[model samples]
Target: MNVSTASARVPEGWREVNRAMWDERVPVHVAGSFYDLDGFRTRRDDLRDFEKAEVGDVTGKSLLHLQCHIGTDTLSWIHHGAARVVGLDFSAPAVEAARALAADLGHGPERAAFVTGDVYDAAETVPEPSYDIVYTGLGALCWLPDIRRWAETAASLVKPGGFLYLAEFHPFTEALDDATGTRIVRDYFSRGAQVWDEPGTYADQDAVTVNNRSVEWQHTLGDVVSALAAAGLRIEFLHEHDVSLFPRFDNFEVRDGYHRFPEDHPRIPLIYSLKAAKS
Candidate 1:
């Protein structure tokens, strides 16, 4: 389905549908072990090696994390040396949970802040003057129907000389089937939104049984790069990785907190990250 079809289904439409779905998932995620709340309570870091090396030192920098669900990675930046961090999301429950989690973790407002707002409306909802770094977490880009608008919003939030960093599921990975994950089951260049009506989530497959319906769009690497360029950001580097942070496919084996395909399997890029500076 497309945005037009999604818009016709209900009042306030696709965004509303996604928001409600996430609101329902927040409680499950907080209590689930997948996010490892128990682990985060003792450890201030939640970021992986790739992010640390690519983004470099955030020490004393003001960072903005867009689509920061539950603030795990956002708070991780603080542990890495960011002076201040602002996390924004569309889900109110997620924002509330993130604030409570931060407080419980001894993070006061001085170190971290959480805002509930759509990424598309971030410019108005968030503070002005931009930030030293704008970070977008994984699995974030597919939720939105418009990448151009998303890129513009991201660029608008970055100060000149500052950069926007993104780590996302590759469009090639999205084309593979969700079960076996070996065969390509969807179109890689699809522009319209694909409707999903699955129960539970990637975090936990058997936690709940609600009909979690949502809409997702596929965005190509060209789409991402062009959008950033059109928004006046200079591309620095784009890298694709063979390993994924989560188990996206059945063939992946969990090791060292990342999922990897068997050595014999065909090598394909499952994740990608890019850094773009506002020049």
Candidate 2:
């Protein structure tokens, strides 16, 4: 929010464009009810039930979170019993907010740290060369232009025997129409950049904002698995779920703790998670 904007994307590229947008949204997200900062302060941060179960225990293990937007989830790892955690993001504002929130939670730099760096440069940017666990999730891969490069970078950060865990929105949704989510509207396997010229942040669709244009890429579930495999990480498991934490379509209804299509509607892979380990 404190960050200024209005730079043209043509001169800077997708990273700059995306960074500017997120930098601008830091204030909005911090204050908005979407993040529920107040509630997080009162409760111990836990990942989604499935995520927590899949990731197993974090007790005393050093963990690194890639694309850790504002460190809310980063700090949660500590609360979940990780001995130490480091959160990395390209947006300085997001890292700043994360650090501020970490301090408020009584987590000093020694226990919880946040760094400003591009995801591609994470292997060299973070203080530690590798970690016991490298975690990436919650809509991270779409921001990347090269899934192979991203996988290589993420794989390089995981210590031998440690694993990289990712839980992401299924890329299949990108192919479906937004309204009913049943019609095909875009190429499911296209590698071209998808430019979205829209206003407001996802947290507040109606919010007045300046950095509106964003460019994102789509990587199919196959693309992700293959990339990690090429990066020297052995495939552990790939699991798909029919529910999402956020409402992704008009017909999606909230059930239990996640959003799902109606009972009569055929289930689709709304979200997917995987664990690939360094042997």
Candidate 3:
């Protein structure tokens, strides 16, 4: 929002514009069935199996989640045996919700904590200098414009022998047609701030809302991997999955606790996960 795009002059900063939209949607997301807050409180974890397998065990280890929206996934880490967990988000309302959820789950500050800050400032915003695991969940990277800055910030937060894990919607999906998602209509390597104005959040698209405009950027997998490797982290592995946690396309159907193209449709990588260790 800072830079003047050809289309519009958004005087508001990206953080301000995006955070406003997220802040307005925090309550809607929590109450909506998408998050399943009640089921989560009852000890049901929504973390995908692939994420658990790649991150391995967290027993007694410290973890930091950057851009950690409402901290649903952050609290889930504490339940999975993390010694302590810290969640950082740009939205004050999201952080408040996370703190309330932590309290509801009977976790004190030592065990569960949340901070309100920008992801680019994570190195200084987090409670500790470093953590055993620096995790970023799905849909996080697209919000960031500078991939290298984000990589450096996240890498700086990983302790020696620790790793930074990221699970995100594949940038490839962005290049496809929005409706059918089969034709490549957009530039694959385009790296610029994209402005979007939609009426509702992904959770409940039908629900009316204010603060509907948001700005985002696209960072390709190659760009992300190269940036992290340049930041002094050893790339462990990059795994692309055909499964999507949500209905990303009209043809997508639920299968094995995930959504994917139906039997008749060809599969494409809908998401990807990567692990880079700070050795």
Top lDDT prediction, candidate number = 3
Q: What would the per-residue lDDT of candidate 3 be over residues 1-279, giving only the tens digit for each residue?
A: 123232233235877898889999999999998898988899746678999999999999999999999888998888889999999999999999999989998999889989999999988888999999999999899887789999999999999999999999998997887667889987888877778778777899887888877888888999999999999999999999999877877777798888888878877899999999998
* lDDT (C-alpha, whole model) for all candidates: 0.87, 0.87, 0.88
Off by over 4 Å in 2: 1-12
What lDDT score is found at residue 93 in candidate 3? 94
Best-to-worst lDDT order: 3, 2, 1
> Which pairs of residues collide in candidate 3?
none
Stretches of candidate 1 off by over 4 Å are: 1-12, 178-182, 209-211
Per-residue C-alpha lDDT of model 2 across residues 53-135, encoded as one tens digit per residue = 99999999999999999888889899989999999999999999999999999999999999999999998899899999999
Weakest lDDT window of 10 consecutive positions for candidate 2: 1-10
Residue-level error in angstroms, candidate 2, position 65? 0.2
TM-score of 2: 0.94
Q: Which ten residues in a row have the lowest lDDT in candidate 3?
A: 1-10
